[model samples]
Target chain A: MEQSSCTVVDAQETFSRAREQTLIESVKGGDTLAYHELYDAHVKRVYALCYRLTGDKALAEDATQEVFIQLWRKISNFTGQSRFSTWLHSVAANVTVSYMRKQRGWFQRMFSIDESEAQYHAAPADAHSIDLEALIVRLPERARMVFVLHAIEGYRHEDIASMLGMAVGSSKAQFHRARQLLKAWMGYDED
Target chain B: MTKTNFDDALKQQLDTLPEEKHPERDLWRGVALALENEADTSTAKPGWRSGWAAMAASVALIAMVSWYSLQQPSGPTEPSAITGEALVQALSQQHEQQKQALLVEYTDTPALADNWQQQLDELDDAAAAIKAALAEDPDNPALLRMLQNVYQQQITLIERVHAPKWQRI
Candidate 1:
């Protein structure tokens, strides 16, 4: 009975994937309803992704809008070599990271952590979410970015290295550094 | 396709990080308006593919600059394992890759100048000379600047040939 239930759940997931794939095809054809459906399904997740990367609600909101707009413009490039959500997440990450970079000053490009550490801490406190998300926002810029991309998004260090233009070792080091910093701040062992 | 499962202290809390975090305001309205705005631009200015050409040019330019900066920096530089030779090889490989892609893309596009290929060949020779000079004096700022100039010229050549400027009437 347990095995059969697992099989049924797997079947349901497969069905959902197929349905979403078909909807993506419709979206490729510039179907407005299909686009809306895709947005309805993916917006919150995309927004969350943007928020985690930017650590700013306003910036995340802007990045979310930009992601969808970019999706509409570049949907024709979706070659189906990867899953739609995977491709969409890639787009969202690229958009968010680039947006964050642009919003930085010339000095921030030279230094990973900005003076905004105080500002990031100054944001409103969320009572219910004192876990990873809160600590994530508290991380310095580079560590936060590496942590989000590696830990939260499950990107391999190799891919993160390429996207962020660093070596694979540095990417791994950043992830380690991020975990240690988070653990220190949270006063616990996460590793 | 990220596996959100964690196996540490925050495992339970991490599990609670929902896949979706709804925005405070409805954003579809802005998206719809943007779609309409883009639609207007498309119809108003036909064949905006040049915009992509422009963007590609910018990306390639940035990549070249980034490659240079990564080579000549201390903090946040490329991995320690990548030596100066590897840096040169990487930059050359990146240049060749982008150059080939540009050639393929602009194969049928009308050239702005009949002598553009000759100009590119000359720039390539200059870049080669600069590389040879840098090989002798790796830390020469003048040589590095010249190398970057050569690269910038190559990208400018590609962009000009593929996405020529519009002349005002």
Candidate 2:
């Protein structure tokens, strides 16, 4: 029974992967249904990537939608040189990075009002659910991206390097730095 | 802690993090419907737009190619524009001459008519094969390049034959 269950699970995963490949090929051939299918499959992962990068829900949501919009515009250029997930991640990474770079000038203005805004959105003090995720929000941009990819998404340094256009060594260094920072923030030294 | 231990710890932490969920399918469906409803009739939908754009782009690309071709000096109203058949004939002529040149190198005397006749017969067979291949794909750039290279080599061989060898001073 266990062996049969394992095979069933493996088959399901394989079927889904093949389905995604078909959807990508169809999208390249200009099929709208394929677009919808691809969008549905990836929107959350895209949103999570954006959210982790930006640490702002609204910005993440907008970036996620814009990423899909750009994907629709550029899907024809995708000649399947890389896995579809890798290509999509690269697009999202680039879009988020560009958006963050452009928004840096607004940081000073936002900093002034950040405290009041934080208080307004703050959940109850004893809330375990919110505080854990809230700790992630405080992480620096590069660290957050490293943590999201290396930690949350199970991507290797080499994969992250190709997706983010960083050197593999730099990706490892960033992952190390992100881990150290997160450990510090969470007060793990006492443990 | 050792590097391996640190990595193991990090992996555990990452795996333990909560998976994020987005708004429900119905909400996304509603958004999709709204976007579709607002679609500009002036600009056709995405798939059709890409197809139309691809066709337009191909035409423009071909036009650019023709424009560049025009920039090169075309001989004025010449009856001898380079065509596929002309090119095959040129290659046949070339292969024959090259075979003769190679044969002459062995024979010491350059003008052995019997050797030259055998080379010409081989060239005729080669030219027939080339003509058939070129007929299948006349516009293939790779074949065109190969044909051009053969023509240039033949010209050089002809020049070599015509040149006078130097006398000792």
Candidate 3:
């Protein structure tokens, strides 16, 4: 009975994967309906990533829209070497960072302005519902980005460094800074 | 909380973070509209050709303004005189009128980027800086050219962002 149940589960997984591949192929062939279906399946997760990365709802919405728009254009580039979700999340991260860079002034970008604390204080009342998330937003900008990308998004420190244009050491330092700040805010006793 | 306990608690909190978060607003309409516009722009050859033509015309206008400004007397002059200052004023007035018209025409159109106005303002600031430089060296062809390029960039940006749907089709 257990052996038969395992076989059934494996069959279901195969069927789901096949269906997703077909949907992706149709989207690549300029089928808007199929594209819409793909969007519906992935948008929530994409928005969640963008929201955490940006720490703002409106920016996240804009980033999510951009991600989908670019995804439609670049869907054909998916060689299927990795899972589609993984590829899409990578695309989302790159697009959100690029979008934010374009939105900032040259002076701000050059100086690497740390507005994370100010933004945290100004965070909407609704964001305070989650304790850790609120604290994450309060971290300094670089540290916050590193933490969200590493601790939350499961990216390697090297990947975070490349994405944010910082050294690997800087990425590690930022992550450490983020953890210390979060711990302090959470009232964790530090030795 | 002890360090070990804190680590565990933090890990738990991270684990509980939802994988999916629906946006407060339905974003499909905007995405669909942008995709449709992208398709239209790519398919419409005449519109693409006209975009290039418009850019060429702008370049020609800039040259004309620079030549005309060069013909006028250099150094401090009457406010109403047809010097570089007058040319700047004329260009600024024309740019403002065109911008306002574009804004009105695309009042309902969704902009592709949220910070386009801020970008335009930044370009305007660059233009102002060039104009200030021109004030010190009224006959400086380089300064005049730089100012013209900045203005051209502003016009291009505005048109690119708020381009009329009908025009593309």
> Which model scores highest in lDDT?
3
- Model 1 chain A: weakest 10-residue lDDT segment is A119-128
Q: What is the lDDT of residue A86 in candidate 2?
A: 78
Give candidate 3's error at residue A23 in angstroms. Answer: 1.1
Query: Which of the predicted structures, 2 or 3, would earn the higher DockQ when compared with the native?
Result: 3
Instruction: Give the range where candidate 3 chain B is weakest over 10 consecutive residues by summed lDDT.
Output: B44-53
Badly placed stretches (over 4 Å) of model 2 are: A104-132, A149-177, B1-9, B23-169
Model 1 residue B123 distance off true place after TM-score fit, in angstroms: 58
Task: State the lDDT of candidate 1 residue by residue for B40-134, as single tens digits.
Answer: 56753312233333333444465456556656656653344455556567777888888888889988887644445765776776678668866
Better of 1 and 2 by TM-score: 1
What stretches of model 3 exceed 4 Å from their correct place? A1-9, A106-113, A118-130, B44-169
Ranking by DockQ: 3, 1, 2
TM-score winner between 1 and 3, please give it.
3
- Among these predictions, the greatest TM-score belongs to 3
The C-alpha local distance difference test score for the whole of candidate 1 amounts to: 0.70
Candidate 3 lDDT tens digits, B23-131: 9987877886787667566864222223333434545466556656766878663453466667777767887898788778788987644446766776666677667
Q: Candidate 1's residue-wise lDDT over A1-191, tens digit each?
A: 99999999999999998888877876665544456668988898999999998878888998899899889888888988998888999999988887776785524662754444532343334423456786787777677788899888888999888877778998888788776665555444344
User: For model 3, how does the per-residue alpha-carbon lDDT over A1-191 read when each residue is reduced to its tens digit?
Assistant: 99999999999989978888988986776655456668888999999998888777898899999999888878889999999999999999998887777766524853566655543343233322547776775677678778999998899999988988889999999889888777666666676
- Tens digits of per-residue lDDT for model 2 on B1-169? 3445545655565566555547332234433433344333425544433433343344335534644564466655323366566655665677667757764664554431222233333333433444565776554444454444434433433333333121111
Clashing pairs in 2: none
